[model samples]
Target: MFPASKQAIGMDLPAGMTLLLTLGVSGLILYLSIRTSWIWRHLPPGPTPLPLLGNIMEIGRSDVANSLKKFSDKYGEVFTIYLGSRPVVVVTGYKQVKEVYLDKADDFLGRGDLPAWNNFYKSQGVIFTDVLEWWRELRGFSISSLRDLGFGKSGTEDGIQEEAHCLVEELKKTKESFIDPQLCLRKAVCNINLSTMFGNRHEYEDKDLVVVLSCIQNTFAAANSSWVQEKANPNSVFTRSHLLSSALQIFFAGVETTSTTLYYSLLILLKYPDICAKFQKEIDHVIGPNRCSTIKDKSSMPYTEALIHEIHRFIDLLPLGVPRKTVREVTLKGYKIPQGINILPLLSSVLKDPTCFKYPAEFNPENFLNEKGEFQKNGAYMPFAAGKRNCLGEPMARMMLFLFLTTIFQNFDLKSSVPFEELDITPLVSGFGNLPRNYKCAFITR
Candidate 1:
């Protein structure tokens, strides 16, 4: 019914609408940019970031700890970086890390939301839970339970000693053949946790043990499922799922970090045989050849103790301690951080700080030794981290490291398959934790 001119004009309406939509999008982007600028203006300074992407390109494909060190050098110890659209404040150096985690512990006690962990835990478990009361109760219960189970007590040493013997027997089976020690070490370490937790240890060939290990390895993969459906129910505290989730967290944490540390210690010793000789001499003097080493012998074996501390320092295991969130607004180093800002207490930065250690980059046992050669504790040595939310398995892990290393070194002389120079001590994977590259070593019975 309309005229031909009107029909022609109606056809142009679609084009006009398209143009309006484009303008609206542009305005929205502009507003967002301004908002982002305003938000960042108050935070600590760091590298400039592109809108939406925000420093992802800068941090690409590099070890995050190393990358963060580079940023810390440029932006000072306290600086901010964007992980996608979210701003993460990185606190480096021992002074600053201690200030946030120790001095103002209560202010920085909240847990940051990690997508992968949230999918698995649904805000449950001591490691990832934000429920303050629940975290306190569970943490207390766990510590008490561990103590009751003879963790760090004389009663548990026999079990660890027995496991060490089992490990030695297994290694002896290798009979001088070049073998990658990863699987054996993993099993030994895992079995210790299993024995402690469930009062059962598995043989090397146990299919159930294999299945459990596989599940742990694939935890991040399985996290995306709807297994945490009970999270929505208000009355579901300490439910069956919660118990399993907590157990899984403890098992994974107890096994992976301890085993990886042992692996690194062996690799480092192989690289510096002179250091190894010194370590063995100290061990021989203190523990002798006939009997297994116990935790009580640690005081007399200062060099061996120093070597273990150096391995932890040199390896810089966790690198970035689990990300923390500000429970409320906090003022750190004169910079105001609002509630819910994700914080990374860069433990690697502190571990490698030149002010704290003589040779931060090199693997030196003297870092922990005084001029008199007695083991001196450094305040900066926080391999298990510090404060209220520090690693729950610290006592157990320390015991295992000392017992396992001393037992193995006492019974066998570790020899690398390749020349010392050919050995690669660099981490094969450096995300979440540092994992040493796989290599063959000969465990010759002494």
Candidate 2:
């Protein structure tokens, strides 16, 4: 008998091709099996992943948070989940998340793999880039530049107040007719960011501003006119690509979260008229009807403060948050995580951690309110996330949420045609953002 190799080569063309294909497929299967086993061997325990698919089917498409919560329940808080072949360690609950962000911050400073952004950003800009030094410099530069442009200051409050006035005027145009507030809210928020970036505000109907709102190319073009004028040093970290990326990151990040939070706050308030009444009562007593709301008034308005905080915690926007990665080999909760491993510190887990909030599953402002009705800060309140990579725009976002919402409530009563029982406060899309369901409401002048 011929040797096995000789016999395979000696076969008819069809037989030989068939043999070769079978052998190749068998080899691939063997390789993948070994590689998969090896990968899981070193990482923390998790649901068994199939080759190539890697726990993706397990995760499903919608309801990623609920799926991860199930894994956290079965495998414990610090467990791994694979997105395709990539193994991302899912750190849930306050204990594990705090440790990853606060305790082992230096080790996990690198941003995690976000395939959607990584394909485009490619390790550039402050948001998606993995370079720690680059992030540090860019973050510092951005904060300083924004400070110069009046971010998180009295000047910013004035700008927001002006924008809020414009928003009220626009809503007044609706003449108490039911209008979807999403576009108007987004535009208002976008203008505030534009003012910070360009040093001037635009008319709501300005052709350039409208184009910028509708087209991303014009958005970058607008950004280009402002940032490219900055003086550069020979070894400056602010390269053209970095500047553009930073500009894009700032514009999107600045608008989306704050605007979405405001949108959700409105829906939640509309859902509960009693809560909305109390919130407006607090605003009326503190800020009054004649004057615009300011940041200083935030301190004296505990119920208002508590309501804002509750909105953040209840909606749980950015449930998973931006992923993080390990800069070096580190052990978390006794499990060894290798360098460059992606981590998802579940912000939803912390925001709704049972031990931290009294009504973790409900939308009660009492979660942030103490016995005296004073607004109390909860350590688990991490809508802005925690650690070294916490949101740079937290202060600005807080101010916007306070000023814009207060201004709206102070000026008009939010009325929706949808009955209170019928209003759906559950997130319409829960994957990346916990957004509210779309509905029309009239902003009646109060």
Top TM-score model: 2
Model number with the top lDDT = 2
- lDDT per residue for candidate 2 within 1-446, as digits (tens), equals 85578666767478778898999998997798688778667888999887788899988467788889999999998998878788899999998899888887899899998888989888888888898989999888877877888888888888899999999998999999998898889889988988877767778777766666667545676558656543566566687778788878888888888988888888899999999999999998998889888889989999989999999899999988889999999998889899999999999999989989999999999999999999899889889888888988999999999999999999999899878899999988788668789988999998
User: For candidate 1, lDDT tens digit of each residue in 74-193?
Assistant: 999999988777899999999999988899999999887687889868988778888777788678866886788788888688889999999999999999788989889989998898
lDDT of 2: 0.87
Global lDDT for candidate 1? 0.85
Candidate 2: residue 428 lDDT (0-100): 81
The C-alpha TM-scores of every prediction are 0.91, 0.93
Model 2 stretches astray by more than 4 angstroms: 1-20, 225-236
Error of 1 at 413 (Å): 0.8
Whole-model lDDT per candidate: 0.85, 0.87
Per-candidate clashes come to: 0, 0
